[model samples]
Target chain A: MARSSNGESVFSRVVRILEAFGPERPVLGVAELSRRTGLSLATTSRLVSELVEHGWLERGPDRRLTVGMRLWEVASRASPALGLREAAMPVLEDVHAVVGHHTQLSVLEGREVLFVERLSAPGAVINVTRVAGRLPVNASSSGLVLLAHAPAAVQEEVLAGPLESYTPHTPTGPGKLRALLAEVRRTGVAVCPGFIDERATGVAVPIRLDGRVVAAVSVIVPNDGGAHAQIPLLQAAARGIARAMRPGQE
Target chain B: MARSSNGESVFSRVVRILEAFGPERPVLGVAELSRRTGLSLATTSRLVSELVEHGWLERGPDRRLTVGMRLWEVASRASPALGLREAAMPVLEDVHAVVGHHTQLSVLEGREVLFVERLSAPGAVINVTRVAGRLPVNASSSGLVLLAHAPAAVQEEVLAGPLESYTPHTPTGPGKLRALLAEVRRTGVAVCPGFIDERATGVAVPIRLDGRVVAAVSVIVPNDGGAHAQIPLLQAAARGIARAMRPGQE
Candidate 1:
């Protein structure tokens, strides 16, 4: 019931301010935050000061501000994704060690795939996915696997395409994508050669918990014939994670 | 500033509500939340509803409330500790593989040690650390390493001790802890045997960024002679993480 002058709740304005920060831009000035949130200067200043006082945001010696460690602690300790990420980590490490490339775990959130965790070595192939980054639900192999298992309405919405293309190999046509989704559901895996980037290949498999598709586990390697060898590895890892999540099953 | 009837800012009250959730207690009913936050029932109900609407909190099917995935995503994407954790993860994985136990990275926050990341194999030691969990400044090896290098004021405050001991090996006396602090600073590592739990030993070394001690890398193994051999491995991993943090360093 507490509304700001613009008829929005205080909680809504606070979220807008927090959303202005990202992996690419971790620190910002008060004026920039105000401009991004479309909030008045006085309101933004007061909010930022209070946030800093409670360790939800931190101030630098240069007077710029960044999200605080306490906020991360509070969010991470109780995140719904924490159990999945923890269960998948050792298996992901095994896959990374044997396969020697980029490995990741993601879940379908809204209309995009939100990456929950990723592992890569110093000399691995290029990967654009950060831990909390998001990509279009039809652009990456992990996204495709998730989209294949999405609810009927979500599937139909994507099928009514304005599908964005990332590279030459990306499937932009709704018909082709629909056929690909059917194949993924049939085969229980997704493989895309140079879909997101021309120089790499992506392979992913569904991770099921309680007989429901919950996540996608994937790896990125060079766009060579070697990708086929990794599908079995990915499938095994997904099964292992699912078993870890549901310990009493099987 | 929007102040509640109690003269505290609403932002502060919101943070208090969030801080009520922890690793041990992730979900709670609204009445419990009201009691934990010491806010009136009406205020807590209004705030919780607004937070749930904004996806910062979730109302479970059973009507309990938990932290939401959107909050985790927003906090994780911009956390200051993300860079350090990412840099240390590979090294931590290597250490865990070699040590066959629990490996972790922690930083000094306020007067306590806050673990940012942890890796544990199934049926490892009986360690008590978790990612995003905090421990007293004098209670664990990681905490000791961080406390040894902490600011003078913090060191003095902790040394003026009401130190709570978890086991007989925990150094509760100020004089002995002062000597241990000097030893850690001299040798650049802390080896605490049975300090936290009786069955495990903790070993830690400092991680430096830009020539300043910024974090601690640690491992927990059975409280036996085998843990001594792991010292070199832990020291090497700490050095590797420090180098990764400063890319141009040797």
Candidate 2:
């Protein structure tokens, strides 16, 4: 959520302050946050002071500010990502060890694939996925598997809009994308070569919880060799994750 | 922040609504939520309606509301737990593969040991520790290591408090705990036995970043062994995590 330059509400301002901290800019000073948020310096100072007092933000020894442990603790105790991510990590780890590549778990959020966990090798094939990061629902194999199982309206929304092409192989046409999704649902796996990068391919299978496709488990491997063989491994991992989500079933 | 009994802010109400959803109960009806939150049915309905509109909560096909991916994405993206966790996974995986027990990462937060990550084997020793969970600063080995290195004020506050004992061996007297902390600092390893549970011992070592102890790496093993033997392994793993955390180290 965003607000106008000069008339933003306090809640929107707090959201903006948190949003200003990203992967590349994890820590910043109040002045930098003020500049980035387009808020007055005095307002920025007041807001940062309030947030810090509430334990939502913490100032480092260098006078730079970052997200607070309290906020992380609260958020971690929040059930959406933490519970599913916790259940998936061990299975994701198993897949990573077995596949000797990058293993990731993601869910469909709006029109993007929001990564929950990713485990990678030191010199694994370069993967663009990052934990808590997003990829277009039509660009990555995990996204496609999720987009395939998504409701028709969500699919229509994604297919009707801007489809970003991270690499030349990323399917941009809505018609081709629709066909790809249909194939994904039919086959129960999405395999893509050079969809996000030329040298990497993504293979994914949907993870179901309570008979719904709640998440997707995927692996990133070199574009060469039998990438197709990775499908069963991913499916097994997905089954394990689904079972973990449903404890009694496990 | 908790508001006085009545008239809570919408954000606070939304947070309370979220807190109602836990790992045990991931989904509930709107009425069930209201009953759990003590909010009027109308107020709960309206707030939950807004949450659904904002994608912070989603309704499943069964008409049950569950923690939505949007909330997860926002909280996860803003979390301090993510960066260090990403760097530690490979190293923790290595240790997990060899040790076949729980491997945990913790940081001192407000005189408590806040666990950022914990990887456990399916049939590993039962532990009370949860990822993003807190342990008393004097009860667990990780907490002991963190408390030993905490600022003097934090140390004093904990020592001045009424310590709660989980088991017979849990040190409750401030004087004894203070001595134990000193011993932990001297040995570079915190050995806690029968504190959390009588069947287990926690072995922890501080992980240094830029020569300051930033976190603690720990493992839980059966209490029967000489815990001193596990120190080298935990210390080496902590060093590995520290090396991974260094700037431009990866």
Candidate 3:
């Protein structure tokens, strides 16, 4: 492996370059890439050239760099998340058909919930969560379900403090969050009205594999009084996803 | 970028490591990684450690290496394919619901067709295509549709030679393939019966944006002489996907 004069490895620099692109900024100029990655113009240019040569980054007709399709293929084909998403898709489609809103599958990633799949309709309720997006563990229903089933160490760390509130109804206090988590575990579901958006209610349930919670399946629907009515459907869908994800099951 | 002793950059080696994992083999031991990547054990070990540290690769409980969630997130969130998949998903769902078979969205990558999204029912006909999977340009309906609209240079290259046949009915001869491509262009659809599998028929239509073919939306159903009936539905769905993908639409 090669290292720069600043002691950063080439792999590290490449990671920074790749991370610079996101849902909000899918393409960037070389100068913007250099600024975003905090690398010198020459180094950024050289790295970008190498990346483009390997098809990990693409230079469009306008010469702006975007994450390449080859990179997406390589990352996605063998991703551990792919298996989970595959298992959840059918169930999610069913749920989305019934709910006619936003149905999502998410997993615990570090201290946040990373959404791996989401199905939305044309006139679906407002949903801030997009595929591959993340939200604080204490700010969404899926997060609460995952957090409730998370390891003790993870729960303690999240409960330590700094729980950012997205809406006035979001549970930010450690004591209230702890109670909410307990309720989630006891009830086997998390239903939060106005957790992230005032007009939406999030309902989620744990998806277990081999008796260990691996992910959460949730739906974002209008914050009407009918939110709880979808709980059974979500739980059933979660169970179906778990069954489909089990080993040796096609 | 740093170069190894043999002048190979770290980025190139990392690409090899990532590419070594695929749908058939998603997990590998360190020794297997060294063997698959053709990198020395010491180099592979050090690189794997660095990759694990950055969460590009994860070490499972059994010490096997798999592509990490962070890598998938970074590669997916800004992927150019993500926008296409998002636009095609709802239409694909509709097609899948009506067809009750395998509905897919694919794009041309070099001389191959890469499936980016697919929806399948449990009892559907046998279809080999998977999400993020690839097939030769002349071996599938989607490939033929994309190849029909591909640049003339690419078409000539593919028609030049080495057209691998998946089944006896697959178009292998240059003259036949050229005629088929012409038919696809003229009809605005490709119907391949027994192309990839004897029991399945593939029907595809081009999805265009800015008056240029961008992708192929297809469905695989039983090869029961009813494949052509799906042409209109697929064309409508393709048009809907293109409209959804247009800039500033939603």
Candidate 4:
């Protein structure tokens, strides 16, 4: 890759510019983008124009830049998770219908739990997880299940302390979390009350493919002693998803 | 925008490389990518390596390339359609439950109908539409509805001919399509039985925001004498989604 005089590759600069947009700020002007990306205004303007012309970015009526539908189309159609999400959708819908709250599918990515798909009712329990959103691998039930199956290096890195708590019930200490992980690995499920929010409980089960855990199926419901009852349903859904995602099944 | 010795911008080259991966071929090796993108093997290798480092592409165990989850994450999170899709989910779910087949949400993009989201049951009906897939504007019910509300230039362009036919029931002539577009605009719905497949019927209605058509919500069901009955339910769902997508509701 060719680099500029400042030793930055065009690819890296472009990534920085794209990263400036998020769910909170979906549209921005070139000036705002330059400020956010720490790039000079001239470079930002030229790069934005090129991106717009290529359909990876769009210029709105007000001239603000937004991520384009074309980019979304390409990313979504070629996504590695598309097959997994497609296979999991029906099962997740069934789980959501039965559990009557937030049902989610997530995978461990870069020491965090990235939600690939989520189904929620209008008045379901409070859930901070969104599709394509990330939660720390040590704070949520899905994260706990994934952490339980992660490599020893990742486990030790997360267990080396400094795990932030979302609520009083969230496990922040290394010793308690180690015990919880052992229980999850043994029981094939992780249940935590008010781990993410004080008003909700999260239950998750590992989804295995070819005898290896690839994802987690989870549901969030009211923290009212109902966590254990939802486990069987989640486990069943996880099993169904695993079958659907098996090699040659997709 | 510095260009290579051949005068092609790096951004355009990158776009071509990304576009080489699609639904039919989601993974490719460097040699195959070089052939597909018309870029030299060395250039393709350098670009692929840069993209892999940025998490825009991934190398499989067998050394084939695939779209990365991080790219999907960024595009899905920052997508302009996210707000509309989020607001339309519940309505789509309700329609899916009632319709028990394929419920799709589509938008017009560059003379093609792009399906943004789709919901399907396990054994509902034989449908060809997939999420993030595209269909010509003259071949699908959703396409007709969108084309009816599209600009006059786009209408003329489609009407100029070369309308591909998927089934005998599809309108191939300019005269019949003009009539169909008028009927769609007048009735606020497009019903085409056996348009795409002999076994399925397509029923669609336009979803409007600020008095302008923004998308089409449609359902595909078994091609029987029951398409008209679904129009009312589909129209109601479209109205609900329109209401939900209005400013401040999302």
Candidate 5:
């Protein structure tokens, strides 16, 4: 492993450089990347050039850098999330057709819910979650179901405190969140009305694989008191996804 | 920018290690990685440990290494492919629903067609393309559509090459490929029957953004006479995807 003058490994610096990019700012100039990563301009330039050479970063016509298709290909082709998304996609489409809103698949990553896939109609309700985006564990129905089935340590960690509130309906107190988790576990579903946004209701159910909850399937629909009607649809879709994900199937 | 005694940079070694993992073999032991990457065991071990610490690589309970979710998240969240896939997904779903087979979105990556998104229903046609997988520029309908609209240099490079034939129907000769490209440009579609598989037919259309062909939308259905009937559906879906991708639309 090569080390910089400051004793940071080259890999660490590379990670910092890659982390500087996000959905909101997919492209950046060398100076902007250096400023964002806090690396020296010379070091950033050297690293970016090396990355571009390897096809991990690409320069557009204007010479701004974006994460290369090669990088996405290498990372995505074998990703665990890809496997789950592939298994869930058919059912997700079915749910999207029936729900006519934002239907998504999410998994617990560390302490947050990372949306792996989402299907939405053109004029559906507004959804803050995008593919590969994360939301706090207490602010979305998918997060609630995942949190309910999460291990005790993870549950305790999220329950420790400081839950970020997205809307007035979002559970902020630990006790309220604990009760919500218990309700989700008991009901095998999570329904949060106006949790993330006042205009949408999120309904989610656990997707099990070999009897363990591995992911959540959710629908975000208009919060017009009809969110619960889609609970059975989501649950059935979740089961179909789990069945499709089983080994020896397609 | 740290270089080894052999003058290979750390970034180069990392790329080699990552490239060793693919859709077929997503997990490997340290020894297997070292063997595949041709790196010293000590160097591979040290670098793997560093990568694991940074969440670029993960060790499963069985002590095998897989690309980490953090790495996938970073690569995917800001990927240009993700933007295109998001734009095409709804139309892809509609196509899948109507075709009852594989509907895919692909882009020209280097000299190959790289599938960015695919929607398939259960028991659909036997299609080999997976999301993030690549096919030769002359072996599939999506590839042909993209290659037909690619820059002259790219077209010439592919034209000058030894095109790999998957089936007898595949166009392996430059003259035939040239005719195919001309036909795709003239008719705005590519319909390759049994090019990759004897049981499937691929139909594709170009997707334009700002009057420049940006991607290809394709469907793989059973090799029946009905393949031509799908051309209009595919063209409309392509137009919808292009309109959806327009700036400030969503």
Candidate 6:
């Protein structure tokens, strides 16, 4: 099913080459790419040059290569992620203004939750999620909302094993997580306190389209006593986003 | 200077193949790609297979191909665009909340304005800019700010001629555009009405970093009247975004 039995096709090797980059390490030399991808120097060089020629990778003044602007432009245009983000932006802005906290939009991708968009206040509570970044489906409030509506297989597989907890409050066992997920489904909202960090409590609500939950909108509030007002605001924002995403409207 | 005389490098070809996927047409057949890229069918087939193997492209149920989630993940992770967008998001969110219009961040990419982000209210004013899309330098407020701050040679090249006009309000003539650019530099903002469309007004302010303009923040207000209130909010947000992008901050 593949080539290079380095067990990767030229493409998979290329993808492996790209997967090495992150927020921390954006630029890399060919050697670094080869080391990271565990590909040979020759193969890495050839592929790197090819990518550079195509504008998928750009060579900077220091001769380090990074994912090119062209690649970003190409990948971004008309993506499902882009559509959801656009549709949710206005409502998210309203929520952010009223809440004055971290407003985020996430969708289920694979067994994890991928953050599609997020807006933070200058002095808002610290958040671990980033746009295009992923969090475990069992961790963030956005993740729980996404996971609750996720396919049954995904839920079963996630609940089957090793649920990593970021804080003592994060549900580590299957039974508790299942219950929490059930609550999320029933209430159409999830509040995760000290789940990712002790200082923050995340409140999220699901955004649905075509009769299924397609996205989740969340706000990370500083952990405090009773911010009961957040749930309704988030739910209203989610509904606004859902309405916005519908065709022939807005 | 380029190895792509036939205008094909495995990388560039890969980019072309990827670029063919857009918001309106996210999936296409190999033959469609071949025609779209002007690459031979054989070449297109080989490259598409390679791209799919690499996770840069995915095969649909109908045998069409699309830009893959993996590619978007990797590209978005490493892009400089993300850094700019992140720094701008909090402030942009504020502007979106305050003005309740189209809030955008853009940078100069050659002679065009490359929009990195856009946030709009559900019923916000209509705007032509799209995230990851480009607009001509003389036709967008963001473009005007970048043009005003651009190096002399680049500025000259852009102002010389062949400026495409989107509407009568577009500053296409060299003399008038030069004056407009100077005005933008003087006030640190550009107010463009009907430059791209008759019903919209784009007001942009430079986002300065290290005493230089690195990006522009703008809001598209309806031509009807609310333009005045939007400018101050947009300018303040632009300043905030600039401050956030400063070294060792946020």
Q: Residue by residue across B46-150, what tens digits does model 1's lDDT show? A: 999888987788999899999888888999999887878888888998898888899999999988999999999888999888888888879899999999999
- Which pairs of residues clash in candidate 4, taking residues 3 or more apart in a chain or in different chains? none
Of models 1 and 4, which has the larger DockQ? 4
Stretches of candidate 5 off by over 4 Å are none
For A155-244, candidate 2 gives per-residue lDDT tens digits of 999999999998889999999999999999899999999999999999999998878999999999999957999988888889889989
For candidate 3 chain A, the 10 contiguous residues with the lowest summed lDDT are A241-250
Q: Model 3: residues >4 Å from true position, as ranges?
A: none
Model 2 lDDT tens row, B121-141: 888886999987888988999
User: Rank order by TM-score, top first?
Assistant: 3, 5, 4, 1, 2, 6
Write candidate 5's Cα lDDT for A218-237 as tens digits.
99999999999998898889
List per-prediction Cα lDDT, in the order shown.
0.88, 0.84, 0.93, 0.90, 0.93, 0.83
DockQ of each: 0.74, 0.45, 0.86, 0.78, 0.85, 0.46
Quick one: ranking by lDDT, best first?
3, 5, 4, 1, 2, 6
lDDT of 3: 0.93
The C-alpha stretches of model 4 lying farther than 4 A from their native spots are: A247-250
Cα error of candidate 6 at position B92, Å: 1.9
DockQ category of candidate 5: high
Residue-level lDDT of model 6, residues A85-164, one tens digit each, is: 88887777778888888889988877888888888876788899888899998988988998899889999999996888
The TM-score obtained by chain A of candidate 2 when compared with the true chain A: 0.95
Model 3 lDDT tens row, A1-250: 5788888999999999999999999999999999999999999999999999988899999999999988899999999888899888888999999889999999999999999999989888899999999999998999999999999999999999599888999999999999999999999999999999999999999999989999999999999978999999998898899999987775
Between candidates 4 and 6, the one scoring higher on DockQ is 4
- What RMSD, rounded to one decimal, does every model reach? 1.8, 3.1, 1.0, 1.4, 1.2, 3.3
lDDT (10s digit) by residue, model 1, range A1-250: 5677778876677888889999878999999999998999998998888889878899999999999998898888878778788888889989999999999999987778999999988788778788888988777999999999999899888878688888878898888999999999999999988889988888999999888899999999998868888999899999999998885663
Q: Tens digit of lDDT per residue, candidate 3, span B194-219?
A: 99999999999999999999999999
The segments of candidate 1 whose C-alpha lies over 4 angstroms from its true place after superposition are A247-250, B247-250
